[model samples]
Target: MKSILVIHHGQGVGGGLIALLGLIAELKENNRVHVLSIFDGIAVDYIRQTGATVTVAKSRFYAKFYQLFIHSDAAYFNIIDSIRNNKSVILYYLSKYYFAGKELKNIVFDYEIVYLNSIFISDWARASKLAKKKVVIHVREPLSRGLFKFKYEIIRQTINKYCDQVIAISHDNASRLDLQHKTTVVYDPVVTKNRSQSEYKLINRKFKYFVYLGGMARIKGFEQLVESLEYLDENIRIFFLGGESEYASHGLKRLVRQNLDPFFLKNKRLIDKLKKSGKIIHVGLVDDVFYYYENSIAAICPFSKPHASLPILEAFSVGKPVIVSDVKGMEELVDSTNGVFFINSDPESLAHKINEMSQVTEQDYEAMRTACMTKYKQIRERSDSVTSVLNRT
Candidate 1:
């Protein structure tokens, strides 16, 4: 069987997981497939669901600081312990990779392909160019606003040359940076939830709820979206459902406080208000977001930040009216025909779009929803494209 190694940087339930799922679907067919995840999260559960054995780096701390001290004593011990016992991992990491960062002298792989994630760690592998291994450099986000100026040029430039192939979550993201040749645009795959989607159909006469999904990461424009809610009529509720980013969720919480003060009171009161008048549902990380989307009127992804996002697609897949910012990857997926796009990423513009959505007719909304599902199907079919490339190599 062909040998293939898959690496993941962080374990957020985002594009990486879908990419992992896609790769697993494609690469594991009649091959000795192995995975090395730098971090762990819900994605780990999904990866295991694919039935592939996951052999994480002995020291994931090595992923970012492997050259220095190995992070996660547990992982360090696991790898060392396994190696010392001579427990032969069918597919395994190189010794030096955990012990000596860039100094990782040699990697003995008879495999034809090494599909990798995280530009920080494995980028070195590509840079080392020790063998004829095909490397798939997966990038899910654009550099931060500050780094967008020039800070990333060094690393990105290196990626242009070192990487054998480049896979971006969206074409807009690929074009956003000065990437070199051999780049392919692969949209993030939709996570298929076992739970059925919400059956609540959006009434096109006027929107009742506005939705946004994603951990409250810095680039999601969380504060701005929450702040904008103050200007809109209280009749419409804005529901947020996603994990909160450890760093930025605090600011998002603060913004929520500001929006609710002197306005919304108790949960029962808010529920009653929404029932009588629409109110926001803060269902954090629901089992099936499609359920929420089906009930909701419009799926909102007005992220002003520079990164790829998935909520927009999740909303579209279920035929929800989507409203997003006309920036980066979002621009590629959302258009006036399929969904609404606001040029201005401000509260007023957002509120205006919400107001506009409130006026869409049922027929027009259905047409837009149909357009979105068509696009969703096209993207879904390409979900395993990266895995195909990795296995073929």
Candidate 2:
């Protein structure tokens, strides 16, 4: 069996982490897998549960310190922004990365392949290359134009210099990164073997809920989902089953963002009002979301940005249809046969689509469920794409 070391940027339990867990689950079946998580969070336990050895590096402090130099995409490409942002701490930030590379060398010698879960773990890629271990990077996010293009150039250079193979989660992601020549499009697999499989009974309630699984970030169009409540039928309720984002999860940051950030402030008021009205239900993070998916009529992913969501795949794996925003990475996954698409960031359109989903006749819903299961089976068939690449000499 191949020895694979998976590196994860473990800040939150977002789709990337879930995708990595799914990959680990698959890899452990035929290979020896070890996960090195950059920081400790909710995902550590999940990673350990996969029967793979996992180590938490306790680097959250270092990661936050590094962020002081390059906080955003603009800082990466704009010289003036980069200088202004890192003028005081550039030396320290650079030193941290240097030491991190040194530390990685000590860890990678025992592994044959170092698999980076996302492009964000470039340091691991570099260190793995230096150790002469095969480096495989999973490019999960899309590379757009403008300053992002500059960031892409940097990423391109990294892959050309360091990575033996690059895996993009979608064709859009591969094209956007301009890495089609060396990139493999592997859809993230859904980990269903460990999930609870209770009998799914359609809830006999007046209000049918649509499940939303992800972080509470603006990019996720959560606020937009809340606003859509104004347009949705009273019988339709949305059940949000996720936690706060990395940016707004801590003390002062959370307090300030929840109070000052217009997005959060507005959504807070609306969510509170809707929760009481029974139009919105917030059931924080759960260990297993199968029950929620089984009880709901459909799953909803109203992401404003281009995202390859694990929740959509997980929902489909359980024979549940999805109402997703018509965005690049997501739209390509679902179509009219198994899911309904709404205009990205448009609350009215989202509500309309949610209404459309709720109104689907039981007979039609059964057909959609069949289609969803078919899609899930197709994905599972190709789930070994990453493992296949790793097994290559």
Candidate 3:
């Protein structure tokens, strides 16, 4: 059995953590798996439940540093601002590395392979390389172009230099990062055992709303979804099943307060009306998302950027279709057979697609649902594609 050390960014209940949990479930059957988390959150208990040893460094320095860089838009436009951002980044990392090194020193050499679960945890990959251990970096986010593009470039370069292999969750992520020969694409795994037809039937009777199951940030196309509510039938309701990032939420609130209106005014007004009318519901951060998935008509992932969305896979696992943006990673998972696509950030297009899905006959919907499960099964059966490259060596 292989001795594997998994280094993850934090214990948040996001797609990356869910994917890591699925991988750990696979690895623990024949391997000695130990998880080291950078911070403590909801995922720690879940990881422990997977029968793997779990440890937490409990550091917030990196997360805070990241927030500073991403929130400072002026840094991208001005040299002085960029230099200030760089200085803060350097100082924070220097301190973080010192503490992280001391905390991880005893365990860094214990495993044969150090599996970095996300690019955000590259420091662990660096530490593992310095200890002369094999390292695998998983690039779970499309980081080439965004507020933190400069930071992401540094991370990409670091992984290329220090890691033995890189795993991208989707082809789009791999291509975007320019990780050529050393990278492999492993589509994220879905844990199917948790689902139940009886449970679906029971919970499904409670609600008939459409669902959105991720961060409520602007880049997630939440504003667009809100805008589309205007075009939807008055009886149609949407259940938002996740919380918002504090950074994005704060920025959006500030914009609204200032009357700068980053999102369209009509969209904002429509969202308010929907909320008042009880047509828009926010069910923030539930423990069991499958319950929500089971009850909902369908799932929607409208990220403005390219993303390998977990909600799409989860929806498919539960025999539900999805409406996704026609972007790189999203397009890879959805099509006319299983699900429909809408123009990214276009509310009218998304609304039209929603209406089309609403109009699908019961027989046709069943066919689409079957197609979703078929696609999911095909992905799950690719054993060779899912295996870690370190195992090949």
Candidate 4:
């Protein structure tokens, strides 16, 4: 059996998890496959659940430890901040062993293949390129996250120079590749839950509410979603189902709650106050997302800036209408007849689109649902397999 390795940087929490699971199912019987990534990974859980022999180099502190010693100087700056805000020194030391254990994995990685997940590595200094063998770089992000600051562009360019291929998830991203000869378009393989028709929690058919799933990032259009709620005609309630601020776009739900403080008063006051006023129903973070989508009339992706998002496609698979930002990446999957597209980051436009679609008859709603279902199947075919790509490489 041909032995292979798949490297992943923690990116889209669900999409990445889905892709890895699908890949293992497809590749395992055909060849021996190995996976290397940080600990507490979604991929690691899926692998363990499937009874596969994969490896994890993660712990609560390992990621930070790796950054401090093995990652780039720029990465170390952030690590120092995390360390200074130290809960404990022994905790930091315990976690930094990513370098100690897996640092030499590339040496014995000799059954044959290598796969790098995105261009997130600054440890290219330590690992040697497999010149005789082909390498695949999976492209999930639009560009390098901290490429310039960490001099990762030099590493990316070196990867471009030495790696055999780069696999991008969308055609729009693939077509613009700087390294045309080595570039390939492999649409992300999205595996969705089979929706049961009878399960929709249409508590009030006429009383419509929309759901937005994922993080509360500015790029995700949470600010515009709140603004759209203000312009809305009060009949349709807007619901946001997501976790709050990890970075710049974090704390938005709190900001919204603070802004509306004068309007109400109660013990569990902030979120409850908003829900009572019917401005925004903050669903908080959920474990099983299908439960929320099945009940919602429409699912939303209102990004202030456009990048391909997984939730919009997931909404389609669950047979719900999607109202999303009309930007390049977001607009690519939508069909006007299947779903509605609104002006990006404009609350009034988002609200208008919601009002228009939420009023559709049950039969009409089902037709749009059917059309979206058709689109989801097409993506699975069009996107090439990562293992298949590596096998060809």
Candidate 5:
């Protein structure tokens, strides 16, 4: 059995973390797998539950610095704030390098491969190469835009120069980077058993609610979703399944304020109305996502960015349709058969799509639900097996 070290950026309950968990579960059947997480959250416990040894390398300084660098709108202020708040960032890097080097020295003789689960931790890839082990870099996020584009470019260059293989979650993500020759596209796996119509009805008996899952980031279109609530009918309710804490909700508001899109600002009154009406329920970070999926009418993903979303796949796995933004990676996943696509960042368009979904006849809805199952099977069939990608000859 091959011994592998998988280093990940965060333990947040997002697509990347979920995908990593699926991979870990598969890999542990034969290989000796150990996980190193840079940040701790719900995902850490999930990883541990899968029987993989998990190590958390805590660095508040690095975390704060990275957050500020990426999310803060004012570049100058962000740099200043990062310096002021994370004075230990430099020391943290030095300590990380030292610890990583020490860890490599201890395990280099035994571990055959080191897998960098996210591009944010490219340092691990470099360290793994230095230890003369095969380095596999997984580019899960679209890195061509946003504040860390330069850092992502560096990672792409590093992968091109030193890493043995690069895995991208989607073709769009792969096309955006420069490591095409060594890159392999591996869609995240979905394994949900089929449930009978009676079972689905029992779970979905209460409310005809739509669900939104994932981080409440601006790029994920949280603000747009909030804005669209005003245009939605009062009978239409939405359950937000992620964003675990009050801090996360507050931080989302802060980001909205910072990156206030003109369309969102224009529909600010509707946002206020939805807040007061309580139509949008925030069911923060529940352990069982299937409960939310089984109960909801459909899944909604109004992301403005261009990355493949896990919620879309999760919705399909549970035999539910999705209403996603018509953006690059996201649009590639949904078509008229399984789900509806709204124009990206346009609150009115989202509102229209939500209305359209509400009006779907029982017959049409059943057809869409069947399409979701078929699409899920097609995706699973097209995806390269995680084992084949990791255990490459």
Candidate 6:
């Protein structure tokens, strides 16, 4: 059996973490697997439950360094701040890179293959290559063009030169970096609890609400989703199933909302009104979102950015249709057969599509549900066989 070292950059339990856990479960069936997490959190506990050995590098300095790298492209830095912190930032970057590489090189010598869970840790590919180990990177995020072009170029060149193979979560992500020749497109494996599990807590059998999975951040088109309720009838409602995101666009505004109450900060009066009227129920981060998906008429994904959402797959796994925004990577996953699309970032359009879906007849709805399962199976066929990709690497 091959020995694999899986390195994940984040500690939060999001879609990427879920995908990585699924991968580890499959890989450990025949191969020896070890996980190196950058920080310690509940995610580490989840990884341990997969029966894989895990090492938590809970480095506060490394955490800050990683955060800077992630948010460098954002408008978080001003000229004054840059001028004041330039020298210190450069020193910190160099020291962190060198020390981290040295530590990783020592850890990787025990494994035959080094698998990077995200592009953020692509620099470690070089250390793995130096150790003469096979390097495989799972490209989760789209390589967008922005202020971080130089950083992206470095990552692109690193993967092309040092990595043996690249596993992109979506075609749109691969095409962005122009790594088609070396990239294998593999959708994330979907995981769900059995139907015999307990029912949704707040939602009763007669509730007419759609489930919204994922973070409640502006980039996720959450604000637009909230506004869309204005157009829908008072009886129609939304059941938000996730919590606030770490990297949301407006951090200060979100903080204010958090201080006021953890549920929602945007459209405050409207949200309060909806909650009191039993029109909007925010169920933050449940252990099993499957019951929520099973009971809802459909799942709604209103992401403005390019995303390979897990909600669409999770919804389809239970024969539930989706109302997804027509954005890159996301739009490619669904069509008129099993799902309806709305204009990206347009709440009015989302509401219109929701109305259309709500009005679908019993016969049409059953057919759409069947199509949803069919689409899910087609994707699952690819996701389940990812062991072949590891074999090649």
Q: Candidate 3: what lDDT?
A: 0.70
Give the alpha-carbon lDDT of every model: 0.59, 0.72, 0.70, 0.61, 0.70, 0.72
Of the candidates numbered 5 and 6, which has the greater TM-score value? 6
Give stretches of model 4 more than 4 Å off: 10-12, 39-47, 58-62, 65-102, 106-110, 122-128, 131-133, 144-155, 193-202, 247-284, 361-367
Per-residue lDDT over 247-314 for candidate 6, one digit per residue giving the tens place of the 0 to 100 score:
23467855654555333444465445445645667777775777778778999888767667777888
Clashes of each: 5, 0, 0, 4, 0, 0
User: Which one wins by lDDT: 2 or 5?
Assistant: 2
lDDT comparing candidate 5 with the true structure: 0.70
Model 5 TM-score, all chains together: 0.80
* Model 2: how far residue 199 lies from native, Å: 8.7
Give the range where candidate 2 is weakest over 10 consecutive residues by summed lDDT.
Answer: 68-77
**RMSD, one per candidate, in order:** 9.8, 4.2, 4.8, 7.3, 5.3, 4.7
Query: After best superposition, candidate 3 residue 313: deviation in angstroms?
Result: 1.6
Better of 1 and 2 by lDDT: 2
The list of candidate 1 runs beyond 4 A from truth reads 40-42, 60-110, 120-122, 143-151, 193-207, 245-278, 343-345, 377-384
- List clashing residue pairs in candidate 5: none
Q: Give per-residue lDDT, candidate 6, residue 115.
A: 89
TM-score of 2: 0.84
Expressed as tens digits, the lDDT of each residue in 62-133 for candidate 3 is: 445432222211112334444665675574366435755655675643688888887656655566777777
User: lDDT by residue for model 2 over 233-351, one digit each (tens)?
Assistant: 88887777787544456688677666555555566675575466557677677656778888888998888777677788889888999988876767677989999889886899999
Weakest ten-residue segment in model 5 by summed lDDT: 68-77
Give the Å error, residue 66, model 3.
Answer: 7.5
